[model samples]
Target chain A: MDLAPYLLLAGLEGLVQASVLMLTALGLSLVFGVMRVVNVAHGEFYMLGALIAWACGAYIPGPPVLGFVAGLLVAPLAVGALAWAADRAVLQKIGYNPEGTIVSTIGMLYILQQGALLTFGPDARAVDAPFYYTIRTPWFGYSSYKLFTVAVAILLVAGLWLLMRKSKVGLLMRATQFDRETALNFGIPVGKVYSAVFAIGAMMAAVAGVLVVPNQQAHYLMGTDPLLLSFVVVIVGGLGSIPGTIAAAVLIGLSDGLLSVFFSPTLAKIVSTLLVALVLIFRPEGLFTVKGRRA
Target chain B: MTKLQVEGLSAFYGQSQALRGLTLELSGGEVLCLLGRNGAGKTTALKAIMGTVPPSSGRLVLDGRELTGLPPQEIPRAGIGYVPQGRRLFTELTVWENLEIGLMTRKTGREALEHALELFPVLRERMQQRSGTLSGGEQTMLAMARAMCLNPSVIMLDEPTEGLMPSAIAGIREAVIRLRSEGVAILLVEQRVDAVLPVADRVAFMDHGEIKAELPIAEVRANPDLLHHYVGIAARPARPATC
Candidate 1:
């Protein structure tokens, strides 16, 4: 069997995986980096987004494109609202204590998972692509929607980078992250910023869900793999470093995709797990982060 | 006009009380220094006014507006700027970024930035540098400048001259004087009586979380035993009698 075409296909698939992983991991990184809250329920937010997209796709009375677009628009807003409420009612009430948030988010994870299971039922569902088109490569044809996914992910990440670097809200978030007391002394409402950041983080995960639902089935438990992979990405990227998260996501995503294609999926998982362990032991601060940078 | 008035303010940290009926007042354009030994509750009194420590009892009013029980973030919005004891600049951020954060409450723009730079020209030269890398004196200037960015009517400075060289202390003294002349009321807490005596309009001696004595600058200057009694420092040569 000629492996060259297969390799090319694998590399493209890797790009797709890397793109989605970057979006998901960036959300996780931002939440942890700024709020110092380990949102164990992050993966469930991804799952909720996919389920919301599936529902929107099914119920919206429109063409497939319009339905998919509605799903895309609705899922993130819904997830963001849910996350914001959770932050205010639960996390803030708990004082955002590190250990407490971890436990609370775990409870949230189970609640979200079980809620989806009861409402959406046990079946996996898929949404139709907004546009039906294909691109002819040198050796084969490829789904143009997948390419669109990659492009959209890139654009969203770029937008996020700009927001963090330039906007007033971004400035407030950074200041709060650096020193909550000092930020408060400066009259920046730390609690409100925390809720906003939590919401934004969940919205990013939901976006990844919306983008990927057309290609993958939306199941109640589908968030597990992405959650695991995102943790790997964040850990290897450095906990709070945005650039580090992106770089780590690409590295892990490409390796996972290529390894799964060339070898077995099980072997790919094992290798990625091993990579995380090695990184944790050898360079705990992550590959891209400088020493003493806030984790 | 009285810019700030504290009456019978008391605060407790957990089980132990840190402040006991601390009472003081500051007029617009006046500098009131709180001088005391460590654990004398001078810092606690400042924290209570800033709302960082919740006062158990008493009323705090600024410009005739009640300030008790307001959240710490809201206190700054009520025309009080705090330069905390440690000069807590956001170390990771650039000098400009630190100033930008400081500008949140006042909404002052480029002009405020320029003003801060003019006050500490070294900041202009180090705009892009990370604040953690600045020298101790430069950090002190940045802290004061950051607080001043709020355009606050009343500024509270806690231990601003701690660990600073004579030149840095002199720089701070000059800044405080300028702010006073511009009609900005100041509540300064200092252990160094010599550094504050020249600029303070009145001095309140605190011991055991209560004011032991309140005297005018001239009175404290003439009575060396008062300084020795409250602040525990031998009376030093007073600033030239120009002012």
Candidate 2:
């Protein structure tokens, strides 16, 4: 058996999955890098986006593209507003206890998940991929929609890199990550930076949700898998290294894609779990570390 | 003209009051050294002025503008640059990045960057090195350089010469002297009396929270007893005013 077509398909799926994970993980990395807050409820923000898409489809008559785009744009703003409220209400009050934050966000996650289930029911919901038909590639004999996903992922990553690395706000972000008090001394409004970062992080999660639903589909429970996988990606990448997170996401995707082809999909899951554990065990500081903590 | 003034500034750590009714006045082109031993609340005084530790009841006037309960970042924008203790130069960031963070307030041109690098020629060579890897002298230099980037009218340094070699301390002393020559009002808080007082124009000693004594640098040099009493130093305050 040539097995080339199947591998290509698997690679396409893996790339798309990696793309979604990388975007969300980038947000997590930035937040953790600066604020040291491990937001466990971040997955809920993605779920909220999916819910927003579904609601848009149900209530308003529009193309699936419009609905998905609505979710991408609207959900983050909504979640960001929620996050701002949450930051001022909770995170600010507690004064940044890592364990406490983890507990609070996990609690938030449960609330969002259950709330969605109660509103939408426990059953999974299907999202019509904005691009409905597969683009026939005579040479590869695989759907080019997968290729489209790859292109979008590349663009998203590029945009994020430029924003974090080149722009003035990007310098502030890095400065914030580098040293909070120094940045403050340099006349940086830290509270504003926090809110902006949290919103952007929330937005990335929402975009991840939109990307996933088109191909993999979304449900109240949909965020659960990505949330778990992103956690794995973050741990493997290091707690706060953007480049490390991207590399780890791709590694995970490739592993899943290849393992799925050779072994059962169940085995693929087992291998991915093992990979996560192995990374944590070996590189306890994650792939990148500056002075024991994530930089 | 007074560049910065703190009136009846009392600060606290939780419930314990660190500073009580502390008032300080510094004019532009002046070097005012706050001299004290540990626990004298010199650090707290700097913190209060910079708005890091909110004064429980007081007002800080920077350039005739009140900085009451203002945030730390805003205080700097009001024309005060602070170099906190331990040279808090984001250990992971490179020297250039540390410099970049300092210039975040202003739109710094290449000239300013070149000026900063020239001011501390060592920083030019060490720009790529992470701050943590820098020697204590380099860190102190970078900290001063970072503060310099804000183009501040007034700068406050908290024990910047702590745990440094004589040469490093001398380098900082020269920098402070140069800063004053450039007309940047400076508040140099130091535990080491002789190390800083030589270059200072005026000196204020703090025993508990409030200023115990305020005298010109020449007056301070005359009273070695004052230095011994407050700072617990046995050294005769040097009479180096002839230089």
Candidate 3:
């Protein structure tokens, strides 16, 4: 048995998983970082994106590319608008109290899940990949679409980094994250920032969902696994650290994929769970904290 | 001339009232120091005027514009700069970003920022560094410089010299004097009479959430007993008292 082929396949699979997980976990981290709100309903937004992509494939005219492109644009915007409305209508009313947010978001989780089940039905729907091209190696052939997903995730991450580091809007978000009262005193509409952050975060997850749907399938219950995995990634990455979130996503995503291929899926989950427990015990501030600043 | 008039400003935290019918005024080119003991509503009045703490029944007017019902975020845009207690700089942001926030609020450009940086020359070097890592004195300068970036007609500093050394305190006093000469109204909240006497044109002694008296700096300097009465601290002598 050639171990090289097996390892190569596992690595490629890991990259795909990591790419999707990176976008999903980044969204979770960004929301918690700025708003300090734990949105348990984040995965529901991901589910919404995938389901919306399925709907587009069925209803939209023209080629698969058109449907995929439509999904890419419509899913995030729709999900983001819904998230913004929910934030204003619900989260803002509660003042974003940590305990209240957790409970309220859990309520949102159920509402969205049930809503998806009703609208999209309880079936697992498959989405056609935009391109049929494949890269053939000596031992096997791989889907080019998977590599496209990785490339797209990287580009989105880079764009997000620029928006955060270089833009005035990013500065306002960071200032609010540092000190809400000070941000308010300096004429930053902190309430508006919170609403926008919440929306942007959900949009990130929604985009990831649309990207991954071609590889997987859209199901109302599909959000559970990604949500759990995302929680693991976010906690391990540090509470509000963006760089940490990305690093953690890659680390866990690759490990889970490799372990599932080599050993067992159950074993992979056990390992990830233990990792989170260890991180919580050893470095509660996270592995990537610098002087208490969430870089 | 620009003036800030805070009339009948009453604020409460839950059932407990922090400010009761607080009234004060500061005209351009003058520094009005608010002197009081701890919990005497000095900070509360500033917060109410800034629109952070909701005023139960009061009016805040800045040069004929009503700021009473405006949001806290709007107050700064209405030309009131506030440096709250503890120099609440956005710790995660760079020094330049903190000043950028102020400049952005006022919609002022690089010229205003240059003017602010000129006041604290040292901040020019540390503009790229995170504000949280700065020394206490440097942090105070950054806070004051940030407040000044907006070119506001009124600036409120709450306990600006609380934890600073003599040199930093002098820098704050100089900045206040410079701002006054530039026709900006200032509200300085201080517990120390020594820090206030040099820069304050007039002092308002606050006790139990109301201004007990507003006296000229000369009158307070002449009557040291007045400081002892309201602020609960005797004016220190020029030299340390011999045991």
TM-score of chain B of each: 0.96, 0.94, 0.96
Residue-level lDDT of model 1, residues A1-295, one tens digit each, is 4899998888888889999999999999999999999889999999998899899889988888887888788989999999999999999999999999999999999999999999999999988988989999788999999989999999999999888878889888888888888888899999999999999999999999989999999999999999999999999999989999999988988888899899988987898889889999999899889987752
DockQ, structure candidate 2 = 0.63
Tens digit per residue, CA lDDT, model 3, A1-295? 5999989988889889998999998999999999999889999999999999988887898889899999999999999999999999999999999999999999999999999888878899999998989999999999999999999999999999998999999999989888898898899998899999999999999999999999999999888888888999989989889999899889988998899899988998999999999989998777766546787
- Candidate 2: regions farther than 4 A off: A2-9, A56-63, A118-121, A132-141, A288-295, B94-96, B106-118, B121-135, B236-243
Candidate 2 collision pairs: none
Candidate 1 clashing pairs, residues 3+ apart or interchain: none
Point out the higher-scoring one by TM-score: 2 or 3: 3
Interface RMSD of 3: 0.8
Better of 1 and 3 by TM-score: 3
CA lDDT of every candidate? 0.90, 0.79, 0.90
Residues B1-243 of candidate 3 have per-residue lDDT tens digits of 649998898999999998999888889999999999898899988888887788999888999998889989999999999999999999888899999999999898888888888889999999899898999999999999999888899999999999899888888788888889999999999998888888888999998899999999889888999998988888875321111
The DockQ-based CAPRI class assigned to model 3 is: high
True contacts kept of 2: 0.74
Model 2, position A96, has a per-residue lDDT of 71
What is the Cα-based lDDT of residue B127 in candidate 1? Answer: 88
Q: In model 1, how large is the Cα lDDT of residue A3? A: 92
In Å, residue B76's CA in model 2 sits off its true spot by 0.4
Please provide TM-scores, in order, for all candidate models, with all chains considered together: 0.93, 0.89, 0.97
Give Cα distance to truth, residue B173, candidate 3, Å: 0.8
Per-residue accuracy of model 2 over A73-94 as CA lDDT, tens digit each: 6776787788777777777777
